[model samples]
Structures are given as C-alpha cells and as structure tokens.
Target: MMEGTILTGARIFDGERFFDGHALIAENGRVKAIVPEAEVFGASDVTKLDGGILAPGFIDVQVNGGGGRLLNHDPSPETFFVIARAHRKYGTTALLPTLITDTSEVTRLAVEAAIEAAKADEGVLGIHLEGPHLAPARRGAHLAELMRPMDEEDLDLLCRAAGEMPVLHVTVAAEQVTPMQVERLTKAGVIVSLGHTDCTSDEATRLFNAGARGITHLYNAMSALSHRAPGLVGAALDAGDVWGGIIADGHHADPTALRVALRAKRGPGRLFHVTDAMSLVGSEDDSFELNGRVVHREPGEVCSKLVLENGTLAGSDLDMASGVRFGVQKLELSVEESLRMASAYPAAYLGGEKERGFLKLGCLADCVHLSDDLRALRVWMAGRVR
Candidate 1:
C-alpha cells in the first residue's frame, strides 16, 4: 500500500477558484484530496510548504522547442524529453511538441517520436502539426516551398498518426483544407485548429461546423477581424463555442486588440496564450536555424520573439512563466484569471478538465508553487517534486 503525503498550509488555487488554509494529499502519485489545514489528520509525514500560491501546473498545447533545441531542427522524440524537462521547471506539467511545416520524412519522424514519448509517459501529451497544408498569404515563417494543398495520401497519414497517438493537433488554413478533410481528421480524434489562412467568415464557419475546435495564435497569422470583412479572426470571436490561442508577447499582438478578443470571446470558446517558443527558452543561446534559415533576436530587443535574417518573424522564445506574468502585469487581468489562463483554461481546452488540470479529488497531483511575485518557486508534477 502507498502511504499518502500531505503538503500543508499554503494558498491553493484548485483550478476553478482559490482557497486559503488548505493542504493537498497525494497517494500513489495521485491527488487524494484537498482539505482544510485543521481537517488534515495528524500525520508524521506532513510537510509544511512555505507561504505562496499553489495552483495547478500549466499545460502548454503549442511548444515548438525548448532547452536550446528546436523540435523541427532536431526532429526526434528523445529530444522531447529534453524539452519537457526544461519546461517542467517553469511550471508546465504537460505539453505538445509542435513541429512546423517540414518534409514528409521529418513529419513522420516527429509523429513516431511523439508516440514513443507518450508510451513512456514522458509528460508529452502529443504532437502538433502546424502545416504543410497552409495558406501562402498567411504562411508567416513557414517555408512556402514546403507547403502545398492537401491530398488523399496526406489525409491518410494524418488519420493514422491520430490513431496511434494520445493527441494529434493539426493546424491548417480553413480554406486550404476542404470540409471533408477537416471532418475526416476530426472523426479520427484529431484536434483541428484554424490558422495561417485568409478564409472569410463564411468559409471559416464551414470548417467550424466540420468540428474545428480552436484557432491557433488568433489575430496574428490568419485574416484580421475587420468590421466590414469579418474574416477568420472575426468568425473565431463571433463563435463563442470555439477555443482560440493568442501569443501574448507584445510584438505578436497589441494589448488593445488582445483585450477585444478576450472580452468578446464567449465561454466554452475562451482564449488562452501559447508561447510558440523556439530553442532559446531554458538556454542562453540567442540564435538558431530553422530549415536552413537563421533566426535570432534583434539588437537592443529584450523580448524572446525571434526573427529570421531576412526579417520574417520566426517562432517566439517566450516560456509558460513569462506568458503568465504578461497576463497579469501587462494585460491587466487578475492573478486568478491569469493563472486560470495558464493552467485551467488550456487544460479545459484540451478536454483534461477534471483529471489533469485541477487539484480536486482523484485529479493528478500536478501543481506549481508560486512565490508572492508569481515566479515558479517550486513545482509538483504528478505528485512528485520537480
């Protein structure tokens, strides 16, 4: 039998709300209960945690790379452990290793890597395929040479990958991928997201109807939400039932526009932040290569948003901790709301509401201990100290 350990006397955020004078009990590497400090039975094994906020560990759905390695450049599941281990220290308990548009061979290797990591319980939830199927008009940093229209073979590959992995998130241009392709991917248990497109509201809506659950980095790559045009961004905002991800970095989106999206977004379809991070996170390196293109930070620039030598915006270098802080300090959101976006919102978005993202009874014992200033002081993932 496994004996339970108690972490007591801290402010606890149970994913949905906050509480004081509460302690968590973990047995067999799973959360057994969250109870009042006094209600916690007399146990010799109780450990007192320093004063701070205890919140559910964050779940990041889009992680391009970390620990000084880009997933696309390295393209291996073993490297995924390096990425996950790096983010784990910063409060992310679960993550998706995203691969940008690449060759068919590279894509296949990534999928295989994800499957192996998932099988090993490496904190990797699945893989995110960000495209070879994207709109050229909104391709952003994805190489145009590698992108093309989807075909029958492409659909089959995606379907098979989904069947093998625990999660397979596909981000595509709504207009580039037909309703049939979206339907097939959705039915195969893939989480289809809209991004890198120029689809109008109507065409985007058809994809939504086809079970597109979310939008990737809203208001950045896709069509803008204009009063007259009401393009992809407009459709995502109007539909309150779909989740949307935004890059909270100042360069990626202005605060005013982010406020509009946050306020306009309705429930079930709430907005969350994604780092779209690159290799610089968890490392001191300032530059990296993506498919033969050199990407790095600009001089005198303090942010982690990277750019190519030719000035195309490459992936971001923001991590989960920086993203959460930006929500409170810059976005003017309450700490509770900010924490929710970092933890509960993404977990709920990924459909892991009760089990993985909360500190309730029977939930996974994954949480972060934040200092008064909200930095990650200590982290608990799956009932073990990280």
Candidate 2:
C-alpha cells in the first residue's frame, strides 16, 4: 500500500493531450497513481483544487538570466540556481541556463557550472551552449569577438560534460558547422538547433538532413522566409519532425509569423514559447547593465543603449505564463493552445515528456497551479508546492 496526497478536480495537461481527471497521488517526488475523481483513495491527506488548473511545470530551454543576474557574466553554479528559483516563482519548474557566445574559457566554465548545478539541484536541468561556433552576422546578443570555428577538442569537452542529463542543446549556425560535426553531435544525444546563421535554403536542407531537430527562436536570429530563397525558416516549416521555440512576447517575432508557424505546424506542439530573458526578469528596478551598456525597462519593452543609441529593442522580461498570455490574448491563439505552448510543447521538444514535463502516471509529480488570469498560484518542483 502507498500513501501521500491527492490533487483532485483540476484540469490536467498530459504530454500528448489535455485530459480531465479527478486525482493524482504523489509520494517522494514521483507520481504513484492518477485516478478519476470518484475512485481516488488511499491518501491520508488531500488538496482539492476545484477551480484551478493543474498542468505540467513549465520547461524553459533558453533562459539567459533572471533575478538581475546574467548567465553570460557570472556563469557560476550559484547563478544557475538563482535563475531557476526566480523563474520557479513564475511557474517555470525546470530550465536550461543558457550562455551567449563567449570566449572558450567562459563557455567551459558555464558548462562545468551547469553540470555541477544539475547534480546538486532538481530544477537546474542543464546548459544551453548557444554560440561561440556561429556565424557573426546573426549573432543577436552574443559577443561577436568570441565567435569561432568548430573545433573537435571543444566539442568533445561539451559532450563529456553534459553526459546523460537528457537535454543538451547546441545551437550552431547551419552554414558554419560541417555535416560530419553535426552528425557526431546528434549521435551523442545533443539536440542540434539551427540559429545565428544566414544559411541558404539548400544549405539549411542539408543540415536538417544531417539531423538538426530544432530551430532556435524561429525568425529572430536566422535568415527570414524569402519568397524565392525560403532559407532556414522554409526548411523548418517544410520539415514535419522538427520542433521549434519562439519568443512570442510580441517583440522577437511578429504575431503574423507566429500565426503562420502555428498553422503550418498544425498547432502549438512544434511552436513552443521561450523567454530569452535578460537580467531584468522579475526585477522592478528599471535599469541594468549588460556587457557594459545600460538597459532600461518600460511598460512592455526592455531597451538597450548598445542595440539602439536612444531606445532599441532588447531581450524580453517575459515569463512562461506571460508568454502564454501574449500568445492567447495578443496573438489571438486559443487558451488551450496557448497553454500547451507554455507547458507540453517544450516538454516534447527536449524528449522530457515521458518523465518530467506533464501530469500523468509514472511521471515526476511536477505541476503548476494557476489562477483564472494565468498567474501562478503555486508551483510544485517535484510534488510539494513551494
């Protein structure tokens, strides 16, 4: 016999689909059973959440920084947990602390820190190495001075450090990485995402042929969808198996482009949302420094002096729930679809569906209890809401 608590009468988002069930039993951080409302039993304690929606805790794959600490600047073990904890309050239960393109030493340190952080904390999933081996033209916030050619020794170190943590993402410029290198990385369980490149359609197709499974931030750091050339966007749209993440905060990409992606991909499973946030996330202090430049935040925008002398667009201050809110309320997507983008879609992206991403039997008891307006009511990292 097993005993824990029952979470009942709430909307549940399973990995593949949303289902309405009665109760879920979780003990010692793992789900024990999922029973209908009437059949729920064998629990000494219960929390009946009738009006709230219970879904998988959000999985953020490209978080650059949070809580006023930048990942690129610190790259320390503590920074990883700081980012995760800050996002957790906003319903992100798991996340990959992302590093922008930088020197070999900085990259190596970030990787080591991420590996160590994940070993120590349940919410620190891993590191997302987003550059240093990328085209200089599409390098968004990445320091161009650090961009370099793909070297075997550096690649090996990344692979060895990540081990079998389950979600190691390497975003390389499609035109820059050799096919053999891409193949080797893919075979080693690293998800190859195409980004920060100006690859032609044919070149993009060749990279996809070599097992590139994802496109980073969709239209932000890549070649656009030209009518004649089509580029990486065309290749990704045409490929059915590829899953993509977008910064749907209405700043990274336009709403029409998101609409096209949602339609072409047949829904939100392929078109998930990411924050791509900076240090300003969860901070009310309006001003901060990034790479020695001043950044100011106003209503609905974060601007950097480096990007534009007066006020140019900067990385977002958005959270997972806000991303969902922008998608549904601003982008005109369905509530169910937007919620899927926030939770289940990204789970499927990193192949975390089976264990960590949704509320189902045999999965880890990670869930988010949200209010009517999509605000996070409570967050459960494993089973116990914090």
Candidate 3:
C-alpha cells in the first residue's frame, strides 16, 4: 500500500492564503498536511516542482463543452468523460457539464448521464442546465422556440434530479419562473441561478428572495446596470447573499467593467470567474453547432470569441487557466484574489468548499501547479496526477 505523497518546490496557495517554503502532503486522496520543507522527513513519493505556484485546482460551474464534445449534442457518460478530460488539461479538476436550452428528452438524458458520470469520475461534479426556462429576448445563443415558462412537470424533474446528483444547477429567468417555483426548487437542494432575463432590478430581487442564490455569466445575457434602472446586473451586485459568475474573457465584458464589478460587489456574495467554455476549448475546431445553428470562432486582435453568423455571442472559447490570467493581468486583481475567484469562490457558490476548494487538512487533494505566468503545468485530482 502507498504511504503518502509529497509535493514541494513551489509556493502553496491554500485557496484563501499563500504559504512559502512549505510542502504539501496527500494521503488516501485527501490533504494530509502543509508543513515546512524540513519537516517532510518520512519516506514518501515526492514530486518536486520548479519555482511556481501550487494552488487548489479550479472548479468551473459553467462549462458547456470541451474536447470537441457538446453535452447538448451527445448527452451521455462518455461525453461527460470527454469534456472532463479536455478541461482537466487546463487545471480544472472539477466541473459541471453544462447543457444550454435543450429539449426535455435531451435534458432527461443529461441528468441520467451526470448521475452515472459522477459515480465514475471525481472530476465530473454535476450538471448545469442553462435553461429552457429563460426569456426569449435575452436568449443569446439559445433557440427562442425552446424558451418557455417552468411548469410543474419541469420542476418535478429538476427536484428529483437534485436528489439523485451531487449538484443540479438550473438557470431560469424571473419572468419565466414564478417565485413559488424558485422556492420549491431551492428547498429540493437545487442550486438556482438567475440568467438570460430582461427582468427589472425589483423582479430579480424577488427571485433572489425566493431562493435563487446565483447569477450566471453576469452582465452578459441579463439586463444591464444603468443609473435609472438597476437591472439584474445591479440586483446581483447589490445582493449580499447572492453569488455572481463572470466569464472574464476579455470579449465578454470589458476589463474596466469587470474591475468595477469586483469593487462594487457586496460581501458574503462576491463575483467569481467562470469559463462559460464551449467546444472550441481544448479543440482545434474553429466552429461548432449550437442548437442546429453554426457558431464560428472569430479571431480578435487580443482574443477570440464564438458567435453565430448573425453576430450574436455564443458561449466562449475561454478555459479556466486563461480566465485566471485575465483576472490578474487585465482586471488588475492580486494573484491570491484571482486564484480564489477561480477555486474558492465558485466552490463556495456550489457548496463544495468543505472538500474540493481548499488545500487544508481533510480537503480533497486536488491541486494545480502553475508557471510564473499562471499557465497550468501539472494537475492532480484526488492526489493522483491527471
């Protein structure tokens, strides 16, 4: 049997803070300790890294596809594995395979696939269903015909799925879902997030009070924050108990806007980074099908973005590591803060912080080794290298 493993030679960031001249020890797929290098004396499998940062592995909650696989295209356990493996290369140790606005049959298939995949892969956290319950006006890439109000049947499926999976996140618009529905969904352990809506600030807050705790891809598909009208964007920033997810790709929201959000956001509920990644990530393809429509990757001078032929923004080509770099280099956030936005904050949003987001004792040994430039060099999930 294996005793333990020691990873040294890099600065360790334990989700909340940084430790220098320390070595991390892992055993039985959990963090054993983080001690000074001199104290790591026992015989163990040691992997020494060069000068860099060893931080908690990233947890992405809004990944639509990766490795050329789209959940909407193929809702199966194998597809989830493909997506997990693809994002794992970019330092994501755990992620929710997202499906954007699909039919009921496809949604049911995805729920089953996620339940099975969670049993096989620790990296497959759960599933994020980004709506058939959405506002048609704000449907960026989602087909308008598929958008509809949340009925009892829909709620029943989601509530049951939540009971069967580790996490079942659903995105809905306040206009499409009643507050009562939101309350029941939350009571059933569903992580309800508001998105793809044109609801007013008051309408959004009503849902927030009703049990919606998160805002998806903030400032993108929802209403904007204007002086006269604080839309969903304003409601999200102002709500202390609500968490917000931002794409952080330079193409989605301006760096200045993101910086402003970081400062203006309320406490206990801060803004975290999410890839909102699509099939373009970890793939060579420049385009993919979204709801039978072709979405092309348009190359920009600084970064590329996926858009439909009509020029509507699709998902994104961003990866978790690149999103972290953007938070630091573009948003002017400190390294520790940026890392937290990627790992700790999202994990907190999904209520997985106790195990997966931190490198403290008893936490899962999911760690990422990054270069000085913040690129992922090596990734380990549950103390085993991926």
Candidate 4:
C-alpha cells in the first residue's frame, strides 16, 4: 500500500493545456488523480495551497553551474547536487548537468561525475555534453585548445558511461561528425543535437536524415538563418520531426526572433525553452572564471559577458521559471503556450511525455506552484518537496 497526499487549489497545467482545478491525489510519488477538493476526503494529509498556478515542475535540458560552482571545475556528484539545489529553489525540478567543451580528461571526468550524480541525486536528470566535437569557428566561450575531432573512442566512452540515463544529449557540428558516427550514436540511443556549427542547410538536412533529432540552443552557436544558405537554423525550422531549444531570456535572442521561431515551429506540440545557465544562477554578483579565463558580468543581465576575455557568452544566469515569464510577458507568448515550452515540449524531446512533464494520473508527481506574478512559491519533484 502506498501513502497518499492531496494538494488542493491549483490551476493545473496538464502539459498540453490548463484547467481550473482544486485538488490532486498523489501516491507512491506519482500523480494519482486530479479532482475537486471535496472528492479527496479520505487522504491522510492535505496541503491546502492558496491562489497560484500549478504546472509540471520545470525541466531544464541544460545547466552548467549554480551557487558559485562550475560543473566544469568540480564535475563531482556533490557539485551536481549543489546545482540542483540552486535551480530547484528557482522552480526547476529536473535538469541535465551540462559540460561545455573541454579537454578529453575533463570531459571524461564530467561524464563520470554526471553518472554518479544521476545515481545519488534525485533531481539530476542526466548529462548534456556541449562538446569537444564542435566547430572551432562556432566554438563560442569554449576553449579552442580543447576542441577536437569526433572519434570512435570518444563516442564509445561517453555512450558506455551514460548507459540508459533518461537524457543523453550531445551537441556537434554536422560537418564535423561523420554520417556513420551520427547514425551509430543515434542507433545507440543517444539524442544528437546540432549546434556550434557552420553547416549549410543541405548539410543539416543530411544530418537530420542520418538521425539528429534536436538543435541545441536554436539561434546561438550556429550559423544564422540566411536567405541564400538557409543555414542550420533554416534546416531546423524545416525539420518537421526535430525539436529546437530557444533561450528566451530576451538577451541571447531577441523577443521577435523567438516569436518567429515559435510561429514556424509551433504545431500541436513543439518548441522548448532551455536555460544554458552558469555559476551566476541564484547569485546576485556576476563575475566568475572558466578554464582559467576571467569573466565579467554585463549590466542589466544575469550572465552575459562584458568582454571577450573568455571568447564566449559564458552561460546564462536565467532559470526556467523566469524563462517562462520572459517567454510570456516579454515575448508576448500565451501563458498556456509558454508553460508547455517550459515543460511538456522538453519532455516530448526526451520521449518522456507519456510519463513525466504533465499534471495527470500516472505521471511523476513533479510540479511547481507560482504566484500571480509567477514567482516560485514551492516545488515538488516526484512527490518530494524541495
């Protein structure tokens, strides 16, 4: 028998849409039911929450660091838990600890750390390798000295370590990766994302046909949408089966540009948001160091760089919750649609929509409560409050 709990007075966002509701029945860390408060009379404990919206806990497919620790530096299980704690305070209940391009030694350490984090940390979803296998021309913020050609041994070590962890996303330059290499990783159950590249639309299409299903951080770190070439962004827009990640902080990309992406990619369900956040997340002061390079924080932003000292934008200071607010308020996206981009769409990208990313029976009891202004009030991941 499983212990049960009831959460009342939430306007539930069921991944696809929202409905006026008051109570949810949860058992064994899964959503058991969504019903009126009066119907949940027999629960042993009832949490009577006040006016707020309850949606599936936000999922960030990319997180670099938080709480003054860089995953690249620490790359430890404890470091991941630290990142998870910092973001959970901001309403991200699940995330993939990301590692930017680094030396093969650092990459292996980060992968091993992520594996251990997945085992020990409940909020850690998996690892996202941003890459050594990237194009030098597009390697923004990544140490050029550490970038390398994609090789069989590199792929084998990462794949073997990741095993079947929920999300195993790797960003690569399509031209840099051999077709057979892409197919092999794809067939091995890795979700290949095209990013940090200068591939043409034709090359992007060829890679997608080979098996890439995602575009990492949409407009950034890749060739732009050109009329003549149509570039990687163009190919991603034309890719009907592929999902794309948009950084909606109003800094990385212009609001109108994001709207254009949504207009092009928006169907019944597509398009998601990711906070490529850095160590500045959950902190007010902005300066940090990466790979021995000093990074100064730009004014009026969370994580934008003030100089090219690091030759990159660094990571973001934005979290998933504020991303929703930016998408809705600044980008003029509808609340319902923005919430889906924050939650459901990413789950679909991971092929976990049927189980996670929704406020429905049998789904993981992961949810966030937000005030009228959309600030995080509380969060629950798999029925455990954080």
Candidate 5:
C-alpha cells in the first residue's frame, strides 16, 4: 500500500493559527510535515481539498456513546467500534468513552473494555468514569440511587485501571471525595475532575490545589456562582491551573454566559468543549436509555438534545463538529478558538501522547475537513481517512 499522501488547498488551522495553501503530508499514519504546496512532491497521491477549513480532528474527553449505541446500555469492549465509528463521522477522531454512574461491576467492565479497545489500536483515547462518586444533590442525569462517596474498593479499581488505560479520568464531587483521595488519584496518574458538586469556592480551590485538574461540564449540575458564595462555577473560571469542560449546547449554557466564562477563564488552563455526548449523536435515532430510563432527543432538534421526562438534560445530542459550530455561530467564538476547544485543548488535558492532538510535524495525522459553515465533511484519524 502507498503509505504517503499530501493533502492540499484548504485553510489549515495549525492549532495556534490559520494558514492557507499549506500542504499536510502524512505517511504511515504519522505526520511527515506541513509544507508549502509547491514543496509537497510525494511518493503517493496528492489530494486537493475543497475550499473550507482543515483543522486537527476533535478529541472529546467526555463521550457517552455514538452511532445509536449507548455505552452504558452496551458496556462491552467490542461495542467501542460502533461508538467510535459513530462519532468519527462528526469529526471526533479520538474520544474517551464515558460511563455514567453505574454499579461497581459495570464500572470494571467499562474499564476493561477501554483497555481492550486501546490495545486494539481503536479510536478510544481513554476512559472517563463520570461517576458513582458524585453528590446526589447534583447528579443531573446520573442514577442517584447508585451514587455514593468513593470507597477503598472504588479507589483501588481506579488505580488499577489507570495503570492499564492510556488515560483514566474520573469525575467526582468535591464534598463527596476528600482532598487526600483526590491527591492519591492524581498521584496515580488519573485525571481527577470535580463535578456534580455544590462546593463553595474555598472548598473548590482547596480540591483543585490538592490535584483535581479539571471540572466536568462546568456550570451544569453544579452549584452556580453567586455574590454570597462563589461556587464551583466561580472557582472553575478563576482557577488558573484547572481545565473546565462546557456543553455550550444553548440548553446547557447560554451563549452570552459562555462568552463570559471564556473571557473570565484565567489560565495556564482554560475552558474546553466536550459533547458529554450520548448514543444519538451521528445517528438517525434520537431516543436512548440511560440507566434503564428513557431519554429522548427533543422533537425536531437536529442536535439530538437528549432530555429526561422531567426535562433534565441527560447528555448532549451534540457532536464535536456541531459543538464547534455552536461556538462559532451562536456564541460568536472565533473559528480558531472554537477549533482549539474541540481539538487541541482536550488533547492537552488528556496529556497522554503529545502526538495526538495538534497537526504539527511528527504528530499523528488526525485531522478534520470542514465545510465553510463548519460542518464536518471528512475525518482522517491515525493517518487513515474515515
């Protein structure tokens, strides 16, 4: 097989900036270089792209399912293929298959599944355990009955999983999990994220300092900011070293509020986009079960927009491509910034392989080709077109 190809003639976002007329050269599933179009004489094919934007393929750190397959409904290693293929069509070349609050046994199965998928060199970048360790007061769509504080067995399972998975992320509540536990998880190389909390800023900052590197779906299912008590939202915006993920699907957060959060994010770490996507993404079906409860995509809602009967947002019907579009068209984020949130920032947070996120020389050639309106047209992952 010819292992090299040069893709040309699109506006390329190199993570930091955009350049037109750049040729991205890939060989053997890795980037050779991005050179001037004229300089890209190659041993294989040279493909000319239609006018649009070309950016690094999105890396979603919090995806529940894709392609009409819900991970929680089918928590087996083999199911990752269906989910990965589903989300790939929407430009998420890499993702963490998120398992929401479930039993201990199910959690173990999900972790094993992720490890197996990773071993098979599938599109899974990691595993996100969104929790059985969440605060009941804030457990949005999570099964409150299954929720509880983290115990020793839970901690041990997580530690073992971290050792096996390329990346292991767990979402917990600040009040539910002690700072020492958070420290231990971080020490074990797990990306411990605080979520589903009603913690005060003082408690939130303390937890962040103790090793909670991130906050999940910021401003949702967590305490909102108030003058009397700057809550998790305030802490997430102010914590310079902590990353925050936002749904930004109009329902989860308002565009003006999203703009404010983005502006206020003082960072060595900043806010990034996550779909917190459900099974309906990249699929025609809009109804799925979450923990034995039916969650349906609202009528006529193209983004999926899954919600429970009581109108509780279960998970996003959103995909990475559409999330980027929301940022650009709805929130008015610069296309560069939107793309960064969907791709570079999540890769930076995972901190697994440096070659995974950006489209730099020596990096893996995971890329997305988008239409002018910001819809994903084609995706290239692991140097193969998908």
Candidate 6:
C-alpha cells in the first residue's frame, strides 16, 4: 500500500483559484486529496513548506531548447531528456520539445525522439514542429530557404506521426498550408497553430474555421492588427475558440500590448504564456548557433533577449517561473491568473487538462512550490520530489 505524503504551509492554487489553509496529499504518483491543513493526519510523511504558493507544474507547449541543448541540433531522446531536465528546474514538469524549421530528415528524427522520450519520462508531453512551412516575410528567425508549401508527402507524414504521439503541434502559415491540410491534421488529433504568416484576417478566420485552434506567439511573426486590415492579430483576439501563446518576457511583446490582448481576447479561448525558450536557459553559455547563425543573449538586469547576428529577435532566454512573475509584476495580472496562464491554460490548450494543470484529486501529482517572489523552490513530478 502506498502511504500519503501531505504537503502543507503554503497556499495552494488548484488551477482555478487559491485554497488557503489546505494541504495537498499525494500517493502513488497522483493527488489523493486537498484537505484542510489541520486535518493532515497522514499515514506516512509530512513536508512543511515555508511561505509561498504551491501550484500545478507548468506545461509549456513551445520549448525550442534548454540546458545547452537545441532539439534541431540533435534530434534525439537524450537531447529531449536534457531539455526537459533543464526546464524542470524552473517549475515545468511537462513540455513539448519544439523543433524549429528543419529538414524533413531532422523532423522525422525529432518525432521519433519525442515518442521515445515520452515513454521513459512523463515530463516529455510530445513534440511541436514550428515550421518548414512558414512565410518568408514573417519568418522571424527561421531559415527562409528551407520554408516551403506543404506537399502530399508532408501531410501524410504529419498525420501518421500524430497517431503515434501524445501531441503533435505544427505551426504553419495560412499562405503555405491549405485549409484541407489543416482540417486533415486536426482530424488526426494534431494541434494545428498559425504563425510566421502574412495572412489577412479573413484568411486567418477561414483556417480557424477549418480547424486551426491556436495562434503562435500572437502579435509577433504574424500579421499586425490594423483598424482597416484587422490581420491575424485581430482574428486571434476575436475568435472565441482559438488560444494564443505569448512570450511574456517583455522582449517579444510590449507590456501594454499584452495587457490589452488579455482583456480583448474572447472566451472558450484565452492567451497563455510560452517561453519560446532556447538553449541559453539553464546554461552559462551566452551564445549558440541556430541554423548556422550565431545567436547571442543580450543580458539585462531584469530580462534578457536572444538575437541573431543581424539583430533579429530569436527565441527567448526565459523560464516558466520568470514568465509567471512577469505576468504579475508587469502585466498587472493576478497571481492566480498568471499561474493559470502557465499551468492550466496551456494544459487546456493541449487538451490534457483533466490529467494535468490542476492539483485536484486523482490528477497527476506534478507540482511546484514557489517562493513568495514566485521562484521555484521545490518541484514534484508524479508525486516524487525532483
């Protein structure tokens, strides 16, 4: 019989709201209960935390790399492990190892790596392919030469891969991927998101209707929102069934713009935080190569940015915790909402809400204990402290 371990002393955020004076009980790699702290007469262990917030571990859907490992550099299970382990330190218990625009051979290897990684580690949720099918004009840091329209072979490969993995999120431009392709991918259980496009609002909405449920890194690498045009940005904000991921590091988007998006966004779909993190995170290295270009991290007192040689903003040097902090401190969002954006919103977006993104009874005991300042103090994956 597995004995329950009671985690007490900190306020618990059970995905939706806070529970004061409650204790989280874990047993057999799942949440057993959320009982009152005074009633925590556990059969086995009791770990008392100091002060802070205890919330569900963050689930990042778009992680390019971490811990000096880029998925594109080495699309293997070992690289997945390294990246997962690196972000785990920052309260991310689960994430999709994202691959930037790469060759078809590399993409196949990454899919295989992700499948293998998920079998061994519950933290590896699946894979996100952020395109070889993007528009050149909005191809922020992705290689332009490699970008192309999706072919029949590409569609077949993606549909097959989606069947084998837990999640297969692909970012494609409306200009490159047809609505029929998007519908086919969505039917195959692939989460199709729009990005790196210069599509109009009507074009974006047509794809959204066809089954693209997400907008990648809203307002960046996509068409801008104009009063007359109302581009992809406007389409994302107006659509009630679409979720958008934003890099809240204050570099990819302005604080005011983020704040306005938060309020302007419709329901059934919400904006969530995605680090879009790179290999620089959890590593001492200041620079790394992306598609043969040297990307450097511009360090700052509050935040840092990774940029290419020509100064195009590349992936971010952010972690889940720091993003949550930025939401509360900069965006004026409540701590509960900020934490939900990191944990619940993304999990819901990934369609894994029931098993993840909550501290409810019977949910996976993947959790993070954050200090008052929102730094991760301790983490637990599957009821085991890591």
lDDT of each: 0.85, 0.78, 0.92, 0.82, 0.85, 0.92
Instruction: Kindly report which residue stretches of model 4 are placed more than 4 angstroms away from their true locations once superposed.
Output: 1-3, 266-269, 301-312
**Candidate 1 — which residues are off by over 4 angstroms?**
299-302
Model 2 segments more than 4 A misplaced: 16-21, 41-43, 266-269, 301-312
Q: Cα RMSD (Å) between model 5 and the true structure?
A: 1.8
Candidate 6 local distance difference test against the native: 0.92
What's the count of clashing pairs in each model shown? 0, 0, 0, 1, 0, 0
Model 1: per-residue Cα lDDT over 1-386, one tens digit each: 22577788679988778888888888877889888888776765587889988888888889999898888877787788888988887788889989999988898889888988888776898888999888888989998888888889888888998888778998999757899889998998899999999999999999999989899998878888777999988899888779988788777888888987888887767898788888888889888888887898864222556898878888787778778888888888888888888878888888878778788888889888888778887788778887
- In candidate 4, what are the lDDT values of residues 1-386, reduced to their tens digit? 22576787778777776667668778888998877667776666788779788889888898888887788988888999988998998788888889999888888888887777888747787889999889988888887677788987887985686574766789889757987888888887788999999999999988888999899998998999978989998889878898988877767888888888888873443679899888888776558888888877776443354334634577677888888888888778888888888888898888788767898889999999998777889998777777
TM-score of each: 0.96, 0.92, 0.98, 0.95, 0.96, 0.98
- Clash pairs, model 6 backbone: none
For 1-386, candidate 6 gives per-residue lDDT tens digits of 22677798999999988989988999888999888877865445888999799999999999999999999999999999999999999999999989999898998889988888888875998899999999999999999888999999999989998888788999999989989999999999999999999999999999999999999998999999999999999999999999999999988989999999999999989999899999989999999999889999897534698999889999999999999999999999999999999999999999999889999988999999999999998899988899
lDDT of 1: 0.85
Model 6 superposed RMSD (Cα):
1.2
- What lDDT is reached at residue 306 by model 3? 88
RMSD of 3: 1.3
